[model samples]
Target chain A: MGKLKVLSVGALSTIQDEGRFGYRQFGIPQSGAMDISAMQNANHLVSNNPEWPVIETAIQGMKLEAIDETIISVTGAVVTLKINEHQVPMNASHQLQQGDILTISKPMGGVYFYLGIGGQLRANKDFGSYSTYIMAGFGGMEGRALKKGDILETQGGKPFKKHVIKQGTKPSMTETIRIMKGPEWKLLKDLPERTIFQVDPSSNRMGIRLIGDPLGIDGKEILSSAVIPGTIQLPPNGIPIVLMNDCQTTGGYPRIGKVVNEDMGRLSQLNPMHKLRLKIIPLEEALEKR
Target chain B: MNILKEKELPLLQFNKVSWDLFRLGEQSLLLQAPFDIPIEKIHDSAKLIKSVLGSLLTDIVPSYNSIALFHSFEESTIIEKLSTARGISQKKSTPIQKVEIPICYELGLDLEHVAEHSGISQDEVIDIHLNDTYRAILIGFTPGFIYMDGLDERLACPRKANPRKYLEFGSIGIGGEQTGIYSLASPGGWNIIGRTPLHLFDYKKQPPMSVEVGSEVSYVRITKQEFESWGS
Candidate 1:
């Protein structure tokens, strides 16, 4: 088995697989890698299953040392990568020998980036997932984000027979997120023809707080009901907040729209202060794209 | 006995996603029925839909009144199968199973407090709670946690001002008009009343969850001594 020693922990870093599904009934939110495309791309570079666990870093990257020789790939958000102070290109595979130090600088754009090792990242699994839920303090490394001086073990499985690296193809960085009208959209007061705005800097994996016109609906308390990942909730203050992987199982706010599943990934990658347009697409078209 | 009601039930649109499509992520979509329908109608519809679409779907999760059909986002055909199934309206003839749970008064840590808040006697609280049979409204939150409705209005309680640090497994609690059994020890705000000895969740089991949405749950009171024995 091989291992990686964390020398400098970034702002936010955690190990995540695809995510824990089929457990929402218990009030548990789905916590997984923020960017599915980046995670999948890293896995594809190493020819591992796309759902394999990988290290997800926020805007600021971290520094790590490979204890044993291993193959690794970095994907998601343009970031500077270096092996032993030697610059390495992003979105490509690299062979690191024993004692090789790897450093990922702050991302040039996008909020999160993924680092995937060829083999499984050794981490405890609870409730059928490696993702971390900071609020509940369960899953991933001791159920929390990685910290400085932490040592992570790797399964050190065999390397891929062929390394396939796909050159950089920037996804449309437009802040516009497409959503379908929610069940409670009618309950909103002073409903606007359009309420989408650019995502704010405070956004993280937990949720995206949109900077848009308030719905201006005032009402009494609502009955608690089920809330899915993409449900856009308008709190009493009227600002719409889109729930994500780490959202609560149930809420009592009126929702106006649910981001079609296809656009969630793009929404997840938006950097702070990035302007996003909200487009209303028919539910049938959204499902057709799926 | 009359099975159908005389009053006309409001017609609701049932939405279903088309098959042979992968819309958002790797998740296929199947809209089983409308939201906010009567509990009995939703339960019966979900049961019928599950039996009809059981073979095609794998993870079928029912909520307040809607059923979400999930499958690998990679499978394009799952969408088509779900939409096709949604177009058909068929009622299942299979009998629904009901499970009785044994609850101990000794574990009813908040029962006295709840009674005080509701201006009812402890004995009255117990009587009202056990008098009415409840229906499992949904199975969500954690794996195997059962949310049942039909609690006596007298016993309906709100969640704690702040969620408790940890709730014991199998702990029966009430929040607002809903009653539920906790399958795992996790943070909760529900007012705890008692506990059941039966395990609600076991990953090793085939179904993994013991109770399904739409099942009937009855609370059978047991003495403290019997609870102690059962605990052992």
Candidate 2:
């Protein structure tokens, strides 16, 4: 099997993986791959199953076509690749064939971007997650995002042996990032010495609202609980947000800081207004390299 | 119990009871109960801290006065089975569980804005929302939404100051004193009034959410032609 079709589905694209686990106690939204280390290094450069199911995309640009001889690759952000029309390489692994095509484009400093594709991109999983939780439509493909034409079958593989992602092992769009303390870091107070912040263009995949410097309150609201995906809440106009990968397994703002899962893949390749800083560190060096 | 700020914490001494944990990163953990237990013993201490962190758990979550968990503290016997995770249930049981929910009160599009803002009378706002029986305190903000807890403090309101860009996947609402069930519509602001044909979240079931945090839903009302021939 090996279909792929689409032809333009850019401004979004979906699929994702390494998410949806045990169902976040059912309020759902684990929805995976907001750069889970550039989709596990583009499924370790197409060897696949580093949590399989790739394609994410989103910073505009993704065109597809390849109906067979497959084996793709295109790791995270910093885009601009192509295929039938030429220009390739982004993170390595290629083969294309069948009707060829490919493309990618829009994504300068990052916004999701994985691709991967060696076998099984299949679709429709929902609770078990095929990712694509576009505001809870369901999970991948039919669950929204990946528009223009939408074909995407996959079970392809065959064209093998090729891997890349090497130079310093890629991961630098850093604006400083690190973080830790959350559990309402004793109500934040003057903490801004290195906090900078900014990133809010209404952010999505559930959270990431950041705006900077307001933080320092004793408003005392708490109550709501259990949040995830790199927490960092703080909202009461002190503006902080940050949760991601479809956030909302439960929350009530006021988390304070969390980010460190290796800077949540550079905070999922930032973008809006950009500029960051945080730093903080220490919850065991932010779980050091769990 | 009341452990706050905590430094290198993790040593609650379990069943000998001394809870209040924290350290929500690197495998997660949040537990909280320095006092006032009974929420069915905080869901029986979140299912006995997931059977004392069995197989180093993976998720427990149980909110409304806390539970959280999400394992893998690189297992050094998980802080010795989380200082004994309170023997799973020191008696005093009552985990709740009822659930019924059929609703549709003429599709309650806010039932006349909750009877002209609770001055009461859309049949007394469906008789004070069928005389209470709620309690599902927090299934979270979306995905089988839930959030319940009684609600009839004179049918309290306060949420839709402009929030309905859609609202229609099993609707059922109310805001302030809580009440829920949008399950998966997308945009919201609560106050919906009526609409439940079950499926609180069937992503092919198996705990695909159907009321949990402490269950006991209730509702029943039915009518828009039995909410269009509802089923399962």
Candidate 3:
């Protein structure tokens, strides 16, 4: 089996896959890679299945040492990559010899980075998912972030020819994202068409809190109802919170709308204080885009 | 005339309820019953929808008055299938899984505060809590967190002004008019009255949560020593 040891890690680096599913009814957050496409791309570069668990680092980068020869690739968020002392390119696979140190620095833009291996990382699987949910402590590397001295083993595989992904495939931080009206759309007095919402600095996997001109509406609390990723909720304060992968299964705020699935990946990559606009579209039109 | 009578009888007995369908997201739709409808009817409707959709649905999350259905089929297909399916039956199945949770009232951090606020003695508060049985209404907010109904209104207390940063698993508390147990350690604002020794959630088990919506829950008072010696 191929092995890699965590030499050092930055903030919030944990193992993530597509996400744990079919457990939201039990209140389990669908913990997974924030930027879904990036995780899939990283896996593809390493010739692994798109859903294979990968190390997801937030903001800052990490350091890993190859304990056994293996193939590795990095994707998501613009970050400087290195092997020992030599600079390397991202979105491309490289063969790592034993004892080689791989370094990834803080991202130049975006907030999350994904590092994938050529084969499945044999970590704890809870509810048929390898994704880590740190709050409850169940999945991936003892249900915690990657730390120094931690070792990860993968199913050994032969080195394959190197592969690289094309540019423009990575998600771009767009100013406007498309959305469809939610259940309580009528409760909204008006949509913020001219005003741009700023992403709150405290935003994390649970939801993206927006700082903008409060929509002056008598925001009444709805009975707790089901909420999924991308469901934009308007709290009593009128600031909207766009629910993400790790948001609670149910909430009491007025659901204004949900960002279309296609734009969700791009929305996740936006940094704090980033400007955002919502383009409300019909359900049929939104479906057509998909 | 015979066919019309048979069709009309089933619809009448079942109440032939209509639900408001809202498109929650690209892949999810929410069916909402009227507020006046019993939660049991809502649960039955969710079950009926799940049965009708079968494998087409990935999840069917039921709440007090709404059900969210997640699926990959077209919106029109789901709507069409739901309209043609048999109506939600009114048969009520009494929940038999009554879980007796042993609580240590000595561990209650807010016992004095709760007693003062409710104008009752501390011993009276514990007695009242243990007297009534509660039904699990909805489980959400966090993993395995059970939202139970049937708290005595006299014992109802406002949530803590500042929520605790960390509540141990099996921490039982009262928030507003509802009472609940923290299946996992989590930050919460409920007024803590006691804690249970049972590990309500075991990830290794097939169904991680032993109790679910509609399960009956009643608390039994135990001493701190008994709680400490629970597993042994």
Candidate 4:
């Protein structure tokens, strides 16, 4: 068995796998890794299954100490990685000794970081997922974010040869993202033809609020309906809200656009003050990208 | 049929309806019934797809007139299944269980506000709330938060102008034409009128939620002493 002790936690970090599935009808949000490819790349570095639980840290990073010898890798957004105050290479696995201190600092611009441990960390599986849905208080590390002194228990595995990620695989932190018309796309009246939006500070796992030219539409409280990640909804105030990984199962707001999965990944890594441009594309192309 | 032409569809006796299937996202598709189709048919179709798809489907979200299916590689299969679902009869050999909820009106903070807004007495509000048999149409917004219809128009009230930061768990409230109970405490804008003593949701149980979609729910007003004495 392996153990990892948390020394300091940043703004937000939680244990996540693919997500808690098969529970949306009950209104349980699917809490999963924001960027799928980045998470899998980190897992590949440590030779773990892509779906294995990993620590997802926000723009601000975390500090931890290994209580047992194991291998670890970090992915998503270029960040300063340190081991015992010495810089270490990211996107590559490194064997660690007991009591080795690991520190991850905020990225230059990215919003999410993933720490893929070599051994799988165990979490309470509610509805067959290891994700921490903090709103409901039910999964991952006792259903909340890791705090100082929180110890994570894991199944230990022998360290394999280091795995190195090829260059240029990581997605560039692009400002513009691709999107497609939503079910209620026609309702957008004053979309400001070519205006760019800035990510609002109120963004979180549930959804990201965008500050831009108001879509200039009033809502009549349409029948509550299903929504998913990448769904862009325009409320009565006309500000567009992009639903993310931890969004609710259903909503009543008017859906105006959907950021394609390829760009929802880009949207996920963006911090507040990041610029956003919606490049309207064919729905077929958006589905094809997946 | 254009949606703007209708105020709302009838409550019962809808037949031979067809739903339009639109791709929602990469892995999600929505089957929307025409405005003329009854709301109950929407739920029946959702139940059919949910049972048929089994593990192949992820989330099956049902709203007033549509069901959104989150599928993996079974898009064609889901389309095929939903296409044939209209002919399937909505029936059950087992009786649709009616879950009785115990509410303590004393615990609700907005009862007086709800009464004053409706220009009715507080007892009339409680009486009308208890008089109707609300059917659980769908579950969303939060875990186990059931969207129930069939509230009397006399008792209907709009949501609070300013939503509370945190509503107590099990707070029963009305939002627009619907009445619901919060399964989990969170910020909400509904006009709260009562509170239930039931946990309503427990993960360790066979089914986490006490109320399922298509369930018929009735309320029995209980005293605070009775609610406090109720065993887990």
Q: Which candidate achieves the best TM-score against the true structure? A: 3
Q: What root-mean-square deviation over C-alphas does model 2 reach? A: 19.6
Give the Cα error of residue A173 in candidate 1, in Å.
8.8
Interface RMSD of each: 8.9, 10.3, 7.7, 5.1
lDDT order of candidates, top first: 3, 4, 2, 1
Docking class of 4: acceptable
> Rank order by TM-score, top first?
3, 4, 1, 2
Encode model 1's per-residue lDDT on A1-290: one tens digit a residue: 45778999865898888888766655567888877878888877766778888888887889999888777888888889999989988777787888999999988877788888877777878678888877656678888899988877777566645565664455455556777766555566754445546677788776889787777775734455556678788888887888888877666687666888777777887777676676766655766765
Instruction: Report how far residue A23 has shifted in candidate 2, in Å.
Output: 16
lDDT agreement with native, every candidate = 0.72, 0.74, 0.84, 0.79
True contacts kept of 3: 0.80
User: Residue A161: error of model 3 in Å?
Assistant: 2.1
Tell me the TM-score of model 1: 0.79
TM-scores for all predictions: 0.79, 0.36, 0.92, 0.88
Task: Give per-model CA RMSD.
Answer: 6.9, 19.6, 5.5, 4.8
Docking class of 3: acceptable
Candidate 3 or 4, higher TM-score? 3
Off by over 4 Å in 3: A169-174, A288-290, B1-15, B88-96
- TM-score (second chain) of model 1: 0.80
Docking tier of model 1: it is incorrect
Which one wins by DockQ: 1 or 2? 2
